[model samples]
Target chain A: MDVRFSPEQQALRDSAAQAVDRLGPHTVRDLEDTERAAKLDAAVEASGWRELRAAGEGRAPLASAVEAAIIAEEMGRGLADAPFVGATLAAELRRLVGAPPATARETVGFVADLSAPAVADRGTLPAGAVAIDARHSASALVLVPVEGGHAVAEVSLDASIPAEVDLTRPAATIAAGAGMERLGPVEQPLTADDLRRWTALGLGLTSADLVGVMRGVLSVACEYAGARRQYGVAIGSFQAVQHMLADACVAMEGSRSVALHAAWAVDALAAEEALAATAMAKAYCSRAARMVCETGIQVHGGIGNTWDCMAHVYLRRALLAIDVLGGAGANLQRVLDHNGIGGADGLR
Target chain B: MDFGDSPEEADFRRRLRDWLRDNNPGLPASSTSDAYWAGQAPWHQALYDAGFFGMSWPKDIGGQGLPSVYEVIVDAELARAGAPPRPSLGYLVVGIGHHASDDVKQRFLPGLVNGRDRWCQGFSEPDAGSDLASLRTRAELDGDEYVITGHKVWTSYSDAADWCLLLARTDPDVPKHRGLSAFAVPMRQPGIEQRPLKMINGVTREFGEVLFDGARVPAANMIGQPGEGWRLAMTVVSHEREPGELGYVARYSKVVSELGRQVKADPGKFGPEQVRDLGWAMIEAEMLRLHVSRRLSDRMDGISHGPEGSVDKLLMTAVEQAVGHAALSVGGTPHGDGDDMWLKVYLYSRAQSVMGGTSQIQRNLVASRILGLPAS
Candidate 1:
């Protein structure tokens, strides 16, 4: 068995990294700047990053989960204020159930599960929200539970929703009586297998994002440790600081390894196997990403605690990311349930 | 990028699995027992006769000379079948086979391959556990022989070994690292004494300490030139840490599956926290498995071992300890005879962090060597 990426894939990843680098660092001010968000969205779409999973002349939809993960990781590393994750998930759903394509320039948001579908059925919907890059999203593709499986629904998010802890990606809570359009499953409805595949893709991509976040934060902390000297030597020369940064590196690499495996499995393995692998990847990466970010802050000393530093940016994003599909406990429960060791009570 | 076995590897694995099924020797009562060693001797011989022993060794040294992947398959299959571990002498043979003189290789490789001779390492002394270069073992050349005198502790299987890869100080005036030398000394001498050191488990005598008042060995038994012990010892330690030889992934997979079986057999025995802990252990084991597999793949692709081996070693310790803890937590209170297995595993797992370089040393290695952090 081999685990090294091909030279071509490496080249693709390098280009993605370059694109994210060109966007510059994401700060708190940029989170609230609509003009900067629009510019970033235009740049992302112009780079064809949004269409990575869309089918072309000779390619299938989402040709390589590994390539998609590479792009997602770069976006996460740059902390780009764009809806790439949701857009890609929407593209995947369209490919799976034959839904209409999203507009060329319009960003799409995604929700894997709709917690309060009853609010949607009622004429007046409460402020129902899901965490996505909703600042510029035109519509949201959400999965609602049906009798046997799940159905896809598109909801317009023209109504405003306040930002959450992760200011970069705002939660667009839908207002009452907003336009809601049901899509997909019109011909062949999604089955249990489709839901499993969707969950696998979601977990794989999210884990990749966590890997990127951890790596980015760790890189920053390591650089700071080397340059921020005290007592006539770099603090990195001290075992206390060196050990913390080293642990962060290990956690990031471990998350990357498992996330890459899960991403590959999403495309290569069967439904059950892919789901199990994704569960494992998410379970490990969720906690690892948090530890890496927390340690990154600690390594930076007092300056790391300030909002201006990028450490909080990474930590905030990681905290929000881990809760997107589920937390570590929930994913771990999925693993146990898949293994037939426990009931599926905690799995969403 | 792929984790599945190739066609040839798949076939080899299938054949090995069949052979094991037909000739399965269940787990021995105790690894330190004479019967266990007696059983392992023939088992290793059978493996050698079947062309599975020296798959990665050079052809000039009476080996199959195959790629390292075949050896990995053999190891994986052995673990999957719960077969006895390979003889400890095999490790020394691999090291000496590669770095020793032609005379040394010819004299030792055959006996080691056939299980006629058992070997143990004498690198760690009571005062030189982690700082092996500071070992006080002395070997002075007198005429055509070298007289060795020192004490070695935590030497596994020394009681059953016929020979030892001993390290000693040859030049006291030089630096700690440069003055050392390595030798292949016969263990059946009057000056050498081995006393079994019972481990924390209270039932195993697999480890012991060896004392040498004044043991004599021919000068020709030196594996390399004088003052080359440090380099040779590094080689031996690297070989010890190499992936795929121990089939650790398959072994961990077995442990995790057994834990899952126990949990499933009685779901009410554990609380939600314990169940979650069990699931986390399974994930950790899988992560360790994948990490090691990636290392093995890199080796097959011609990438040599580096600081990444330390990463795998650290993960190995973590997963082993996690699994042991989970098993104990789920087993709850032990009822005398029924909980012996869990108690033994829990006690043994404590050593995972201590043995083969402590977890602290591993972190230091990764920090300085792999991460490029300045040494502290």
Candidate 2:
């Protein structure tokens, strides 16, 4: 068995990394700048990264979930203020619903109840209006409950976009009101397997993003420790700092391994196994990434707490990523549910 | 990348499984008893006759010349079948088989492979457990023999072993690590005395202390050149620490399954916390299996064992302890009475962190070696 990527996959990853590298180091200023976010989105679109999950003529898909995850991780490491995850998920949902391809400059936002479905705040406009990154999106693929299953509602995001904790990616609440166009209750009503597959894809990409954030933050922290001196020696020379960084490294590496496996499972394993793996990856990465980012800030000393440094940006992205799809507890509960430990009677 | 076995590997696994099913040796009544060794010898002989022993060693030295993955498969399958814990002569095989002279290999390796001899390692001293280089055991050469006078503790199977891989300082004036040497000493000598050290789990004579009052070993018995003991010992220890080699995942899988059965048997007795702990233990065990699989893949691709092995070691310790703790909590107070099996296991699991290397030392290794952090 081999764990290393093939040459073609490696090449794809390298090109993706190179494209995101052009964005340069993410700064506090980039967070609020809509122009920079738009620029980053355009660059990613030009790289054909947003179309990674799209199906082509008779081929299974142009790229596998593993490939999509690789690009997601790169975007995360760069902290690029692009709607990469949203756009990718939107393409996937659109494909599942047999919708036409999105226009060149038009980004597609995605919003669904990643956990259990409930009534979509009935009084709210467009009914269940969930917030998603829609800074540059013309519309969103919003999941709304139909009779038997969820349906994709193409809702306009022009009226409801708002700021989020993850400043790099703007969010907006979408509802099926007058301006929105309703899609299927698809030709085949969305099955539980379909929802699970979607959840697995979402978890894979989110966990990859978390893995990238932790690695990026840890690298910055280690460099800072090496350069920053207090008692006539690098702080990294001190045991406390060394141990902190070491623990972060271990956590990040473990998270990356699990995330990559989950991403591969999305395309390779049976539906149930894939769901379980996705839950496990999301649960582990959610906790690991937060710990690493927190330790990253700690390793940077006083400067880490400031708005100017990139440490808090990584932490913020990590915090935002954990909330996406679900937090650690939610995913862990999913793990237990999928592992047959749910319900009052054990071994359901 | 693929995680499942290749067709050849699958076939090999199937064949080994069938062999094990047919020639299954039931569990020994007692590990420290002479009857246990008597039963084990034939088992080892059958494995050797089947060409399973030394599958990863070179063909020139009577091995099958397969990749290390084959050996790993054997280990995994053995654990999967719930086979009795076979006597492990791998340390001696690796030490003498890899580094010893051709003469030494011909003399000892065949007996080891054929189960005619059992071997134990003598590296730790009472005062030098973690700080092994500080061991004061000394060996003085006179004529063609080295007279060893030292104390070795935590020597497993010392009573049953026919020989030992012992480490002693040959040049005291030199640096601690540089002055040591390794030798293959016969265990039946009158100069050597073994005193059983009862373990915390109340397992009597599971391991022991070997007192050497000038135990003599031939000069040619040295595995490597004099003062090369440190390097040799490190090689063996690294092998011991190697991920995926020990089949811990398979063993833990059984323990976890049994725990699940117990929980299922008495569902009303457990709380949410206990169930959650059990869930975490299972997750950790699965993660350990995955980690080991990835490491095996890496090894097959010619990656040398490195600090990443410490990652598996740390996880093993964590999973073992977690499962043990869950057993105790689920079994309730006075854990020893109703579930004495789990109680013994829990007691033994405490040594997981201490053996091989402490979790703290492993973290330091990861820091300095893998992360390139400054040593503290």
Q: Model 1 off-target regions past 4 Å?
A: A26-43, A56-59, A105-127, A144-148, A159-163, A184-187, A344-348, B28-40, B51-94, B109-116, B242-245, B333-337
Classify candidate 2 by CAPRI docking class: acceptable
Q: Score the docking of each candidate (DockQ).
A: 0.57, 0.44
Candidate 2 wrong stretches, greater than 4 Å: A30-39, A104-128, A145-149, A158-163, A175-187, A342-348, B16-55, B60-64, B67-98, B110-116, B333-336
Model 1, span A8-118: residue lDDT tens: 778878887876676635565666677766777777778776767675544366457788888788878878767677677667766666666676323334333421122
**What is candidate 1's DockQ?**
0.57
Return the interface RMSD of model 2. 2.6
Give fnat, all candidates: 0.59, 0.39
| Candidate closest to the true structure, highest TM-score | 1
Per-residue lDDT value at B200 in model 2:
77
Clashing pairs in 2: A126-A175, A126-A176
